[model samples]
Target: MIFVNILISFIVIIILQLLGMVILSKMTPFNDMEELNKGNVAVGLVFGGQFLGTAIILGVAAYTNSSIWYMALWFAVGYVCLLLSYWIFDWLTPGIKLSDQLKDGNKAVALLLACVYIGIGFAVSSLII
Candidate 1:
């Protein structure tokens, strides 16, 4: 059933994105949801960045694969690359922990990180085809 495939893909993508966010939360020094509840714009920017990045990759995965399983598998691959990009970003920054800065509500770092994530997402997605 085509509708069933669509439903499965939708569910799988939702789960994968949530899992990616959960893993990112674990890597952070603060609770993202709590910060959002506290009106932390910096945290909001970073989350938006990561979400955009993952969405781009997911879009590409879905476009390139006909089978739902292949789509899900490729999405997982892209998601892993997204996670690695964050770590690489952390290592690349000079003498500052990116996550800590975000927790401290640094808007500049948050914006920069967000832009970097978006750019990386585009870059990674471009490679998927």
Candidate 2:
């Protein structure tokens, strides 16, 4: 029974992570996989940060919630918060369009945005009771 429960949790987490990635890909103007294939380091870093951020949130959610439904709910909340942080970062940096800069292969912008996402992930994870 314990093994089955663990397996289910693992599968659920993987599904949620893939869903998050899909949503993120839709949100961005450029194709992430294509850019990654083109050896765009900036896109790779930003995507890496997103993956790590979601994983952190999912980890906390799975650890804290006993019910699968509750875990999914909390994961959704964390995912929204993670998405909002990107918009907030854009808002904070006036007159600079983050998505545009990222599409243009700006390494500095990507690095800062990646840091913002990861930093927000850490902060949000701490709040996930």
Error of 2 at 63 (Å): 1.5
lDDT tens readout by residue for model 1, 1-129: 889988988898889778878877887878988988998899899888888888888888788877667666766776677678778888998787988888889999888888887887788888876
- Measured against the true structure, the TM-scores of the candidates, in listed sequence, are 0.88, 0.90
- Misplaced by over 4 Å in model 2 are none
For candidate 2, the 10 contiguous residues with the lowest summed lDDT are 115-124
- Give every collision pair in model 1: none
State candidate 2's TM-score.
0.90
lDDT of 2 at 108: 92
Q: Whose lDDT is greatest here?
A: 2
Candidate 2 residue-wise lDDT, 23-115, digit = tens: 887878888888888988888778888878878877887788767887788778878987898888889999888878877889999888788
Against the hidden true structure, what lDDT does model 1 obtain? 0.82
Residue 64, candidate 1: Cα error in Å is 1.3
C-alpha lDDT of residue 90 in model 1: 89
